[model samples]
Target: MQMNEEKDSPAARTVAALVARARAAQQVAEGYDQQRVDELVAAAGWAIMEPARNRALAELAVADTGIGNVDDKVRKNHRKTLGLLRDLQGARSVGVIHEDADKGITEIARPVGVVCAVTPSTNPAATPANKIINALKGSNAVIVAPSPKGWSTCAQLIAHIHAQFDRIGAPRDLVQCLPAPVDKASTHELMRQCDLVVATGSQANVRAAYTCGTPAFGVGAGNVASIVDETADAELAAERIVLSKTFDNATSCSSENSLVAVASAAEPLLAALCARGAWLLGAARKAELAQLMWPEGRLSPAVIGQSATRIAEKMAAREGAGRPEWQAIATARPSMLIVEEDDFGEDHPYSGEKLSPVIALYRVADFAQAADTVRQLYAYQGAGHSVGLHSARPERALALGLRLPVSRVILNQPHCIATGGSFDNGLPFSLSMGCGTWGGNNFSDNLNYRHYLNVTRVSQPIPEQVPSEREIFGSFFDKYGTA
Candidate 1:
């Protein structure tokens, strides 16, 4: 092919060069065996696991994004990367991951080359590192496309990964990213040229991935709801909810957004949440909080991922916008805000995900009403995502799990931590959560190495065991006597 360099736009040129390099590197990566692939993953994970390295990236992310606590981001960077490495141990991505002698077939793993991996601003460091490890583990070359807001921090993380590649003498082209100034044009161009796209950002980015005419794995929306049955432990539930909701200032999409509870447990739940540093906003003060949180029917960017104390200040300010007659309980420097829910339909704003430490509470008559309300909440925003249920009775939890459309029905645990994966749960560790078709995604499980690899099935000759027509139609024949 002849070169036509001047005709290409800046974004197009940048993406084309990146993709060309990635494709060349991918050809090299495709030949790696399981041991070499795992070695690359280990080097990347270990480099990110260093405390000093973790602290620097975490600090950079919080400083650049203007969201999340530094300490919490540090912990997230370590734990999420460490957990994913542990989960994939001994998981073969080389030849013959599975062999079935009985069926005379064998399944082998192959790399999905030149992945265009889109990362989000919320968990910039962790999300990119996690995706990088999974891509390398599957022997796939990745080109990271970070959100503009997360570019600097994400670039730093990628630089760190490149250093690891240098240490191991791996191809630097195997790990690439969009340039310093990222935009929609660059991201779309990257998505179009790659063999596979793994997007983990806003709905727009995910939609772009599907529209780019490339094989893709993208994240789904999440307005995570939690239902507290009367039989649940009120205090323990409150503690877990607070821990998850306030972690990194509600950066995770899986953080609990609403609480549907029975009247019997509502009072105790409220009291327990209060004890655990949740500031309950009475009906009288609801308008003020609403004015600050959902100004003009959209979540205020200033409040999203901000501390609860800062939000209270925004509400109590005397001069600027949202000047209210009453200030919140001044002594209550809560980690999360609790609002009494009025409705669950689209008519109500609080029913959807707030992306901050605000949780809406719905007092239903019973557990059935709670599940129904949760379903309605998902219909409005987070359909096919995740929900948390706390109950002493196993059947009640199981019943809701069976009934809800949510892919991850978190049980008696913090939705933020459990929905993704934790040491306590059996789910494979990952940052990209697929919300299934209901949430406008293709997969319903936590994204991992297997998702990044292509599977090839081989068939061998065997004795035929075809079923006779008589045997195949026995049930039909028994019912209608040989039509």
Candidate 2:
């Protein structure tokens, strides 16, 4: 379709053409050796051009999007690539891939044909790379629909992938992205024709994917809330919170949206946080920060990545009625903290997820109350897809894990970093996490390579020889009841 075409003007026809190409490519893939999939992935990793690809993605992401910084996006892309490669190496996904000698049957790996994958703007390059690599591992072809805010960067990313495929003599159609912006109509058409749908973005996109009647893997919203009990080390907890909230300016879904601290530990934690550059806002100052985050009750784009000084200046100029007493203190990083009593329910606006470095603090009477407060926050944005805890008490940690509705509970570490990348968590490292029961997902983990593949159980009937009554009785009596 022409770039200038309206949403209703032949967008579906274009999508149909792309889907036809994808189906043709899938037929070709079915005949080619499955081992080629693995070879191509490995070659992409080892290719000298991989580093250049990384650099290109970083540059294009910052230049085209004008959202995040280049250096950090580079780090995110590199780490995600290295981590995905390490995790999927030697994993098998091929025809007749598993056999059971006793069952006299084999389980084969089948491709899902074509996947319509949607990605978000927060981590454009990382998310597409992840989806492409996983689809390759599972022998599925993918067509990406990136958010408009991220399309230019995503286009650059696709170009890089095509270059890699050409270098390896692989099918160019194995991975493809929508050449134009996808509106509701185009997205609906793509979803209906695709074999599977994988969406990671706004609620509207996820809902649309589910409504399309195709098998889907999706992630919902995350307003991650963390608990820090009295048993926790104040300094350590503060450090972890700082690291998580400041990481990528708190763009990650797993970043702590609020902190629930025990009343006894709250003061000490606040002290420790101040020592570590976290500015604790008093009632008036807290209100000012809130207004800065939500100017006239809406998110302010200007404040998203600006430094503390810039934010403070903007706030002061807007309020323009006083001495602007709240100058940007060195202790005040971009993130904000407010100490509030624990009776506030999910209706409290502070419980909502703020993508920028804004955090809410709640003081609970005890550990139980802290968990309860966290539950309230989760109810505001159920499951968060993840939660976090900081406590020396093993029982308390386990208690929170059992009681919280989130799929993943990060412990003793920064919620953002640990939830997505923890080796011990057994969750594939990704920016998007699928909220299970609480978040309405069938699975309580991030969608990854394994999710792209399905498992088949091969069962066999035992020989039809019937055991004699005496033998049966003897075996039962010998194993259980004494004869």
Candidate 3:
């Protein structure tokens, strides 16, 4: 397919094309009404089409990229879609999102014309679907720029969306994807042209979006870490860690990069993890695992998202250790384990986020040390995101919440699952989470349907009534102060 040359130029013509489309859609979209938009979105066969979408995305992803498993990708797609829809159902995006009778004012929702969304390889289908749904919710037209690794899956998703739009008689151009690789030039052009850009993926893309001078909502890198102290349930904590680390092969940004355990509970936690199919490697074994993870001092794509057995076999073969006992290796589960003393801090080769099933373990002298260790980890990838703690101490949990730069703090739960979902946390469910201050965004968003749309305030001046000080004091102060 021939890419648009208008996307090549950083001139007013490029901006005009996007603006014209938005202007045209705005007139038609506004006439359709919010209820109509909601009805179309709800009955668009999207929910029913979710399963097929997942399968298609997985098939195309594996065929094109040779990365990630079909089954895992399927699970990711389903879970993300379900969560995204659930969060969007009751959101008051159209009529009155907020109303204040006291001030005689209402904040009516208005669409921000055209939204340009950039998706990542880690989550192509879910991201595009999320943006499309959100833009529709607020009656905004959207254009997508899928990453090179995400092209096939994104194209399939876009096709499905177009099919839905066709069935509903919605405008075809309401949701469009750039029919080309999202190189720096094209992306920069798109960013400059669109009314707003919601970017979720690489830091490079985010920086470009920001530099384009358009309103941009972008996320940063994640190196999330968790802590389990003696006050916590070692068994349950261990199990949660394993589940989170291995969930979708740890592609989630909230997946624990390191587990800092107090020395008092370290042995018991390790044993508990072993009972739950985790293979705890000793000092020398940990070194071997690290080599496999960072071969030639870089992450190996082959090892990423592979089973523990596969990683162990590859490492054993590379070491020429004569196929280190299949039974021992099978029982040994090397992908997730404790690292040696050599790899501890920012200098540690594996301290950052690992997309595969691997975690670094650290033994702290005390609860203070555990908290300190967590602080150091957050320093590597600061707040505006989240932190997980497995302590029963309400005080410690609260303390961490206050101390950490992060916005959301998950307690005694699987960080990966809870971080971006609505099951427990009140936050909206999303695949792309904004890492607030530490991650350098205004809020830590799960990139729900609402994030894709912008709100415009419509205000009508109301006559002001001055209240006497006595009345104001009587209404509030007397109810509490005098009582």
Q: Please give each candidate's TM-score.
A: 0.95, 0.87, 0.86
Summarize candidate 1's per-residue lDDT along 213-320 as a digit string, tens digits: 899999898799999999999998998899999999998999999999988999999999988888877775776677777778888788888888777777777355
lDDT of 3: 0.73
In the predicted model 1, the residue pairs found to clash are none
Q: How well does candidate 1 match the true structure, expressed as C-alpha RMSD?
A: 2.4
Query: Which wins on lDDT, candidate 1 or candidate 3?
Result: 1
Instruction: Supply candidate 3's per-residue lDDT for 423.
Output: 65
Error of 1 at 270 (Å): 0.7
Clashes per candidate (backbone, < 3 Å): 0, 0, 4
lDDT of 2: 0.74
Ranking by lDDT: 1, 2, 3
Model 3 is weakest, by summed lDDT over 10 consecutive residues, at 337-346
Best model number under lDDT: 1
Error of 3 at 269 (Å): 1.2
Error (Å) of candidate 2 at residue 308 is 4.8
lDDT of 3 by residue, 1-483 (tens): 234655445544544565577568766776666577786566432732467766877878767765556787787667666666677776777766887766767777777778888888767776777777777777778888888878877887778777777777777677777756557666677788788898887778887877788998888777787888888899889888988887766766777878888888888988888788777666667666666777676667777656666666676677543345534775565545545342344457667677777677878888788777777776765446777889888788788877877767788898888887856667677767787767777557677666655555666677878898777788688667855
